[model samples]
Target: MSTTWSAPGRVTLIGDHTDYNAGLSLPFGLDRRTSVTVRRADEPILRVRSDSPGAGPVSVPARVLELPEPPAVDGWAAYPIGMAWALAQAVPGAIGPFEATVTSDVPVGIGVSSSAALEMAVGTALAELFGLDLGPAELAAAGQRAENVAVGAPTGILDQTAVMFARRDHGVLIDFADLARRAVPLGLAAAGLGVLIIDSGTRHEHGTGGYGQRRAECAEATSVLGLTSLRELGVDDLDRVRPRLAPNVFRRVRHVVTENARTARVTELLDAGRAAEIGDLLTASHASMRDDFENSVPAIDAAVAAAVDAGALGARLFGGGFGGACLALVPTDRAEQLAAAITAGVVAGGHPDPVIRLAAAADGPRREPDPG
Candidate 1:
């Protein structure tokens, strides 16, 4: 028998670079997802194939899973292979050679966190196939390890945690200081509010130097501030530290500090059923990313401006930034109209035609019922 599993991509509604600094983040699982099908292989080799265009089949000795990282595998296949290594580490002897087919509607490199979705899908399949008793958070950690160690991307737990702990009609509010997660009721659909994701058609990879440089700057700031992480200070502490940090480092530090507060406020607003009031905070978060964090790209900025001008309640660039998707909160009735306006506005600004998706809070990862 074969098991098919899937995990949802995530949208970091607010709080971007703050995760690694042990700050707060609020993310919702997107309806877009990645799925994996797994069954035992006849040989002692881990085989893989993907339906994504231009991806080729990869095969490697199953014993490589025992290593800290699989050096033989690279590219998209490394995500699942790395996940298998992580799962094995969590529960020794729980994984073996398997052949899997991967598929997804989760667009890659557009900031929806398709990598986490892919990892979680493969992790869920391995756990079920081997009967491992891991919970959502544990699985999430393993996914993070896979990315950080196996895939070599220095990402925080936000993507994996958001993908695994997500709830329908709710967003996951995570405190990286302690990895505590609270389910905040989105109440968007009930309030006739919808989040429109406009793909700026500009791609970015977390493994790239730009992302690493941002992380490095945050670390330097943290060391200079004499704190372990930026979470050690609150917004009130920013003024006291500003004079000590370089202008650039200070801005980076400022973004993480203020973003945490914004994330907390948005969580409170959503918890109190004030989802409509979050537009200003979303826009503010974007401004912080653009000016302080220096993560927003010109195309994404154009898309965000168009979204706001087209009557979006509030709009901002979502994901790891640099270049990715922009999220705009809009009335459910006007979602398509807003999308059209964003498209026109983006083209007028001389950027590529953007891909627009209408999304809502969605369920987390799970094993799919066998279709056989």
Candidate 2:
């Protein structure tokens, strides 16, 4: 029997760097997704292949079963290997004797949570192939574990959770501390608007030093202020801790504090059906991330500027932002114009033509190959 699985990538609308701090986050599923097809084997070995030729076939012995240590092939196969290793812990004999092929449209390293999408797809495929009944939350957690332990990135749970559990056409407001979630209806696009993903084409690996440094800096700022997390701080509290922090730490804390407020405001705008008011907040968020968080690279800044110049309602650098992608809120009619302008700007800035796409919010992961 053949088992096919798919999971969507995620976009964080607000509350960046807050999940790990036991705070709230707002993430929505994207239209782009990854799919995996798997079949059972009897030899107790894992065989994997991908559509991309550079990512050659990889065969891992079931005896090894160690994550992050899969045979060093390259590209997308690492994602499946990592997922299998992580899933093995949940279902002791589940990972062995499987052959899988993976394919995806979620652009990697663009902060769209492509890694999490791949992990969820692989995990779901394995569960179907093995006749294991795993819940959506458990699957998301497993994917998060794979990314953290197997991929060596200490990321928060927002990306994985959103991809696995959010609903279509809604933004998931997640309380990370309590794991409570509410699906807030955000019919922004239905109101003659669309969310544009402007791929800067400047890759950012969360597993690398850049992301690690930001996490550490945020933690350091929290420690210096005697707060458990940056989430504990507010705009009013900045004055009290400003003297204790280095300039950079102070700036980082400022962004988090302000960003938390912005998230609340944006949510309110959506709830009130005042989508136009969010434009200013989006621009301010990008500015803070660039000037204070120091995450926006030149390409990202250019893309945001170009989108705004091209008549976008709002534009901001989305995701981790060291160098990935940005989001532009444009009228549905002007989406093409904004995309072309952003592409031209990137070319002018001596970068590759950005991959621009209009992304509609979508549902999270669910069981597909049910064995009835």
Candidate 3:
């Protein structure tokens, strides 16, 4: 038997560095996705391969029940390997011998949650192949398990939740405190605006980057502030807490508190049909990510600057922000010029060629038809 599963990569419009603090985030899945095609194997072995973002392909041989500890593999192999371990735990007796080919356009190392997409796709495909029951939420939890334990990243569930739950015409407003989410209508497309993702051409492996350090700082600040999480604090509470913690930790907490409010305001603006007013909030987010969180890169800044000047309604350095793409809200008619300007600016600033993708809100993971 053969089966294919697909899940879209996600982009965070605002609320960076807020997820781990139990704050709010606004993320939407894109049309681009990672798909895994699995076919039964006669040798009682499980194998995996991918054509994107890595040193090379991988082929692991093992029984579904006796899955080994996730090996420390090179490049993109760890994501699938880690995911396999998680899936086996979720559906031990249901899995059997199979080989998978992973294909994806959502570039890894650029912070679009490609790892989560791959994990979600693999989890869902394996469930379907073996007749195991798994819902999107369970699959998302499985995906997060892979990332945290096997892959060694302390990321929150924002990306996985967005991938599993968002609608085609909206962004999921996630309150990480309780895992309760509501879909906020993103009618930008209906308002003659388009969302664009421009890769700044730098790679960030979340496990070994500034991401961990920032998370550590937040945890430390939470202890010093006497709060359960940053979610307990608000923008108005920052001034009072500012003098209590170390300078850097205070700034990190500040980003979380204000960013949570920003996410809500972005939702309000989207609801009010005032897509253009979001530009300041987007730019402010970039500044906070740069100044307070100290996560922005020069390539991303250049891309955002050029895109906004070109015609975008708003643009911000998206995702985890050490080095990744920027998301821009632009006039649908001027997307080409906006992309061109970003490319030209990055090139002029002496960076690698940037990649630009235009996307709309997309549905969550689903089973693809059997191949013809």
Query: For candidate 2, lDDT tens digit of each residue in 1-372?
Result: 868888999988777776776677788999988888888767877888888657778887766564444344345666787778777777776566788888778888899999988888888888877877788788888888778777778888888888887689899888776778888888786688889988888888887866788889989887777777777777899898899999998888888888888888888888888777788788888999999889889988988888888788788888877888899888988888778888998789888888899988888765455333
RMSD (Cα, Å) for all candidates, in order, is 1.1, 2.6, 1.9
lDDT of 3 by residue, 1-372 (tens): 789989999888788778889988999888888999988878866677887655465666664345456656556777777777777788776677778888888787788888888888888888888777888788788889889878888888788888988689788988889988888888887788888888888888788869999999999998987779989997888888888999999889888888888889998998898777888899888888888999999999888888877778788988887998898888888888888888998889888889997888888888898777
Better of 1 and 3 by lDDT: 1
Q: Give the TM-score of candidate 1.
A: 0.98
Question: Candidate 1: where are CA atoms >4 Å away?
Answer: none
Per-candidate Cα lDDT values, in order, are: 0.90, 0.81, 0.84
Candidate 2 stretches with Cα past 4 Å from truth are: 66-75, 366-372
Q: Tens digits of per-residue lDDT for model 1 on 255-317?
A: 999999999999989999999999999999999999998999988889889989999989998
Which candidate gets the maximum TM-score versus the true structure? 1
The true-versus-predicted C-alpha distance at residue 56 of model 3, in Å, is 4.7
Clashes of each: 1, 0, 0
Question: Which residue pairs clash within candidate 2?
Answer: none
